[model samples]
Target chain A: MADPDSNDTVISGVAPGISRSAPQSKEEVIVISHLYKSFGSNRVLQDFNLTLYKGQNIVVLGKSGSGKSVLIKCIIGLLRPDAGEIFVFGKNVPELNHFALDELRARIGFLFQSNALYDSMTVRDNLEFPLRRHWIQVTQAQVNDMVMEALEDVGLAHTVDMMPVELSGGMRKRIALARTLILKPDIILYDEPTTGLDPITGKEIIDLIVEIQNKYNTASLIISHDMNCVRLASDLVAVLIEGKCYALDTYDRLKSSTDPNVKPFFEQ
Target chain B: MATDTTLKKFLDETGRIAVFTGRFLNEWFRPRYEISEFFRQCYIIGYKSLPLIGLTGFIIGLVMTMQLRPSMVNYGVESQIPAIVGISIIREIGPIITALIFAGKIGSSIGAELGSMKVTEQIDAMEVSGTNPFKYLVVSRVLATTFMLPVLVLLSDCIALYGSYLGVNIKGITSWSLFWNKVFTNLIYADIFPAFIKTFFFGFIVGIIGCYKGYHSSKGTEGVGRSANSSVVVSSVLIFITDLLVVQVTDLIGYG
Candidate 1:
């Protein structure tokens, strides 16, 4: 994203009433510079850099096994990059101690590929896990309200009493998202949010993601290969190729890009 | 080369277990303890294992008495059967058998549960949810097993004694009070205390190894199955080894 001017143009028809933020309000929440990470001889990320601004969704598009998950993991301080700086909220993520990392994690919601809802717990308990674990002080009434509100956000308020196993695939993903929403995170990282769902369910999830983004106005770094998700939810599309952000632009602009590396994503 | 690889893997696993133990020790004493989860684990691990332990104990006691009857009659020492069975059960068989059963059941359960959680990213999700999975899962479970096994053994010993009483009257008449009196007259603290204390070691070995195998499980579904299988095998082996070591120590301490 060398040209700051390119991001000002919004892609329409994907999400209506999305309320995409003004360019002047772009505050950098996550900044990665010259990030390099590798495992054994496999280089997963190399000199990769990205910046996520507040109230914007940046979709990192990549093929499977192309370091998309690794990139998000590094951003969330789950994995330490081999080299370079990851400035998350002005703190070097890799440099922070355990306590600091945990504090940072509190503000970032990560929706895993598998949904990762606690199987042993009812939907209500799963949603309350973050709030209870973080030692958040709120009245029981307030907690109930918060849980209900998060469930309503994903439109699964009735499933709170049911266990995760009883829910369908899309329902479970929605419940997981509700759990993530319980924290009211400043940033949400979606790791292939639409990976396993059917096409219609995937669209609904993408719409819900956009709705959440618009409703909360939180920054999001979505890693996905799903073109619909990239097209609909992304305010800025970061094309990841060979362990780097190969191209960064609006989805429409990236769709029309002539570069061999960036054309396949938009070829549909 | 194969032997070398196997040895290296074993040493690596040993080192990893040591480090995991050290980590457990470090985090267990830290603040923000998971008290509720700990108690929940205690109930599940301790209270839930009662039925199986009791049934097994009863069978073992009945079988011991019946088997000893033949030998006792041949030596013309048939009247001493209760005392002999009581001494042997409390001193050795009771604790070891209960522990082996505990290892088989609890070890595999923990391994499979945690391994599934690991593979499905639930453990990682726990971390991201602002909870230390180690404290919530591993520490709670390990401490549960540590405290639960001894309690189970104590109860099992009692049940086995009752079963022995039933077995005694199967052939000949003996009053309940008389049977108990004869059994207790020969029993001493030396026979009981060492056996009771060794079970804590047995419990700790089963727990730590089970947790270690599950927590570090990889390779997805196959890895989870391997974790469950090996948790049982490793814990059972370690239980015997720990019993041997603890017995040696007890003997040196004049409790033998």
Candidate 2:
């Protein structure tokens, strides 16, 4: 197995300034320790521990059915783990009451694998949904302004009135991204954002993910099977296999890793 | 041993249904409304189902008029045939038949769409995005169904009566004015209100059950099919159960 702390070194390469010194602050944004989750007899995640700082992009890589998506779901309080603790912004997820959970959710954003845009709603309405539901007190003009801004960021400013069905696959993903950015969430979780897209679109999506993260200075947890995306977007990489995560320093380090499972993944 | 197996199967099925229902209700009230998704659902559930409801309504009216013609003629009351068919079509048949068709089409569609989304990790996407999929998807759908179904039933009732009028005039001579007057005289506020009210419940059941089945669908292709099938069957059965209870209550209060 690769050293769990190896990925700490990779972080140094990307942001040299943040790497030079250790033990600077005690403000951990998200902390998952000893997490174990299962569906029936199938154990998907086990004893997974990770701590995320604010404004960091952590890409999770694993084969199909490796429980990478499950970890992100657990952090967002969507899927409760059978055992372990997930603390977001110093508050334990499981311990929080319903209102607290809602509050926690408001602070994070998610981009889905299939871009689960409500098929019935137009692009404009899709963006408005979260804002309205969160009761963000903005005037109609402000809402319109924000929606346009978000759409512009994704290069879909002209698609405001169009429905998801009318958009191509790449366009739908952009619209989903625009919707994700509408709330200006502090934390963003993406599940297979580049999956099923052409390589050009996939690269474009990866660039957008990086651009968005940098723009908002937000923490991101991305789950993907594409190694290229994992390498491009990650400040830290965690390879999940057999319900356990082997944290790595970088894609290069993971590729060169001597772990039997890690070797085959790179060779392929 | 066989009896015990049957009992166990019953308990297991009931438990699954109960859990599904509970989760749906829990998610239904939580904040986050998907207005676009809801409107899309309304288009499918309300507008799309109109053609089927209309066809069935027309057939129901035509058949009732034709069947009642002979019985009324034997009693020298052939002139009363239009009124009898009109009352039956509006008061009872229109709402129930429309609801059943709505359940078959809209209920199953909601169930399958949501179910597939759940299995495919789309719902999870909403949660991570700080959006409540439940409020956005489920509540809006339930609300749309609640309001739209009553309107559909009302439309179906009107169309059905027109169909009946046409059927009555095929062989016998009756003025449109006299036909409507007779139909309206036999009709009371009592009959219209209860029937209309029941449709809202029918819509609620269809929306809730379809959502419930889809939301809890297991992660696979098979889960989608199961969700769609269960939604139609369960909603259809619930509509009948609710109708029976409503009818009995109305009768007890002397509305019948």
Candidate 3:
């Protein structure tokens, strides 16, 4: 069992099975070690290790089907890892009971790949969803205020009553970001945030992500195949290949590195 | 070779049905509620299904009355046409046919919508948000279907009785007052209550199975089609199974 209160500090003491040294300074918020997962015969993740610190934007770069989404899904408990451990906020994810897992989840936000906005809900209703579910004691005025504030944060305040279908792809992404912000989470996970947008809109989304992270001081883990996004959004970059992380470094360092496999991906 | 193929098909169908039922039961009690999503599902699963159910009920009544009239006339029981068709429609035909129609329309929609949501990672978004997607998606749908099916069945029964009257008057002289008098006179509480009661379960099965298929659907467009097809097929089959049990129980309790 892992202590829920000391979730951030526990990751530094645990290594990725073979390494004994800590990956970061004392401010680490997530630590994953020897994590393994499989779906039928497909082994998606194998003995993967990662450590994310507070306010760090860790971009996971991988080709499609390289299990970047699975890694995040495991951390969020949507998909269970076969072996090893995940500690978020110092709580070992697998050991935490359902109640604790839920409590932990409430403090985290996720921006889905497709924006995942409920097609049936208006933008206002979509933003209101998490608030209403978890914060029942909040007054209607407070809910309204918060929803508007979140929408304003994403610059979609005027599209409150519009359904998801009515919005452009970029607007939908912003609306999703607004929905993520409504929870006031300490951490936000983005799955391919700019996969389908025009380059200009994609850049705008990247800037919005940075803005949100800086303003909220929320740690972000972004999974994307978009190299430009990886270059712009990452404080540290991890390239996932062959079920394990090959490199975790700054953009300039990874770009200049002589490692054969890591070099081609960064160069391209 | 033919027997082997048939056996394999039977096993496949059986396995699918079991999995569908099991998943629905499992997801029913799971926590997490998406209220806005649920209401939207209700509108789709319940409200939108009305026109189709209504139309089917009307046709069933008209056809049933027309078919039975000449036979009753041959037996010199022409006066019993409305009474017989009315009892048949209210007691069984109306609820069952409407439910089958409901299963086809609403069940398929719930399946496809949820399937697409699952594929697109929307359900995943809800789960990661600390919201219980199961409670929000599955339970709300089940609740809506449970409540709405009865209303739909009642409306269907009423519309069907009207259609039966129209059929009765097509070839013969019958006043609306006298026609209804004959129909209602034979229909006791026993004939109506059991039939009405069964529809709630019918709705529950349809909603639960449709939602179960959609919510657990695999990734991509292909999964969406599988969900829709399974929802209709499974719900239609369950309606029959449920109708059979309801009939047996009604018989055991001496409803006839």
Please report the candidate that would top DockQ against the real structure. 1
Provide candidate 3's TM-score on chain A: 0.89
List interface RMSDs for the candidates, in order: 0.8, 2.6, 1.3
Better of 1 and 3 by DockQ: 1
What is the docking quality class of candidate 2?
acceptable
Once fitted onto the true fold, the runs of candidate 1 whose alpha carbons sit more than 4 angstroms away are: A1-24
lDDT of candidate 3 over B1-256, digit per residue (tens)? 9999999997986787578567657866554445665677677766787788888888888899899987899999999998899888888888888888888888988899899999888898777666777777777888788889999999989998898989998999999899989998998999999998999999998887888789778858999999999999988988999999999988998985
Model 1 C-alpha lDDT per residue in residues B1-256, reported as the tens digit of each score: 9999999999998999999999999998897698999999999899999999999999999999999999899999989988999999999999999999999899998999899999999998998887889999999999999999999999999899899999989998889999999899989999999999888888888888889889989999999999999999999988888888888998898987
Clashing pairs in 1: none
How does model 3 fare in lDDT?
A: 0.83
Docking class of 3: medium
Give per-residue CA lDDT, model 2, range B64-130, as digits (tens): 8988898899999998887788778777889889999999888988899899888767777656545
| DockQ for every prediction shown | 0.78, 0.47, 0.63
Best lDDT among the predictions, by candidate number = 1
Compared with the true structure, what per-residue lDDT tens digits does model 2 show for residues A29-131? 8888999999999999988888777777778888899998888878878888999999899899978776688788878888888788877679998899778
For all predictions, the C-alpha RMSD in Å is: 2.8, 4.3, 6.2
Q: Rank the candidates by DockQ, best first.
A: 1, 3, 2
User: Which residues of candidate 3, in runs, are more than 4 Å off?
Assistant: A1-25, B1-44, B188-190, B248-256
lDDT of 3 by residue, A1-268 (tens): 2232332111123122111121234576889999999999998898889988877788888778989999988888888889999999999898888778888887788888888898878998888888876644788899999999999998989999999999999999999999989989988999999989999999899888877776877888999877878877777778787888767777666677666667777777
Query: Candidate 1 local accuracy as lDDT?
Result: 0.88
